[model samples]
Target: MRGDGARAWLDEGLKLLAEQGAPAVTLERLCERMGMSKGAFYHHFGSMPKFRTRLLAHFEAEYTTAIIDAVEGAGGLTARERLERVVAEAVKDTGPGLEIAMRAWAKQDPEAAAVQERVDATRIGYLRGLCEEAGHATPSRMATLLYLALIGGAHLMPPLPPAEMREMYGVLLPLLD
Candidate 1:
């Protein structure tokens, strides 16, 4: 097994989750993908529950916290500029099948549902901050609409083409300005 067996397991778990949904994220499945044994898996995670908890944490860090950090540290940008950049980046980074898989997993697992709740709150809260900074009359309402437009739009049928989505954001940007 690799030295960072835990990370490797988590990576495989994420891949399985994205490709085959959370039900496929079994220890057996992960070990099979990693070419490792149960012993190796046990060495990294004490139990399946522990592994699931850590996997959710890893997802939150990779998906939500990292994006927030990047947007906050972007230099020489106004609040609107930062918001635009975030929307543009989000349009490009769809997380492939991961978001859909997670949403489905949350429906069945309360633990996953709680994590999803926190992730949504963090993202929406950040948008609200941007709206407040830009002096929107109804920051909360604008933030909700903006977040729904970006996140909800991601799961739309025949998915929104990136160019058209960018155009939509372009139109919305002036409203925030």
Candidate 2:
């Protein structure tokens, strides 16, 4: 409870979710992982519902908003260039594990499903804009395909390596052009 306990809970919860899925994200599990107690969690989150909501927000901030901000803030990058950079960065980020877990959680939890829907839409929207900038024949369709491929790859047994992912993007570039 001394320093940013709420963030600690969120971070641990995300780890549990990634490793063991949403069902493992209970307060007991998080507290055990953090070596804290229920009182400490209650001090920050008040209740399970509050904790769940904040956890989702934290995931969105860390996984989606941060990446978007980073891509947008990179000076002189064209939309296509930005898109490539975002995908490359994602290949290195641990957020994909959380994403894959969240997708599984979405099937049983409406709130998780709603958050997943919004996240997917926001990402696809950005992809669509980039596709339009790159002059893809059908930006919407192309964006959907690209997003699906990325999401589908996240579910792979070993996940795609960064080099292989870059190669995939290379193969995708001419199609976008």
Which candidate leads in lDDT?
Answer: 1
- Residue-by-residue lDDT tens digits, candidate 1, 116-166: 999989988999999999999999998888878876666788567677778
In model 2, the runs with Cα more than 4 Å from the true position are: 1-3, 93-95
What are the candidates' C-alpha RMSDs?
A: 2.1, 1.9
| Candidate 2 colliding pairs | none
- Candidate 1 residue spans exceeding 4 A from truth: 1-3, 94-96
Q: What's the lDDT for all of these models? A: 0.84, 0.84
Residue-level lDDT tens digits of model 2 in 1-177: 333568888988888899999888898888778888889999999999899998888888888888888998998998789878887876775646787899998999999899989999998998899889988889999889888878877778887766776688778766876
Give me the displacement of residue 147 in model 1, in angstroms: 1.3
Query: In candidate 2, how many Å is residue 7 off?
Result: 1.4
Cα error of candidate 1 at position 6, Å: 2.0
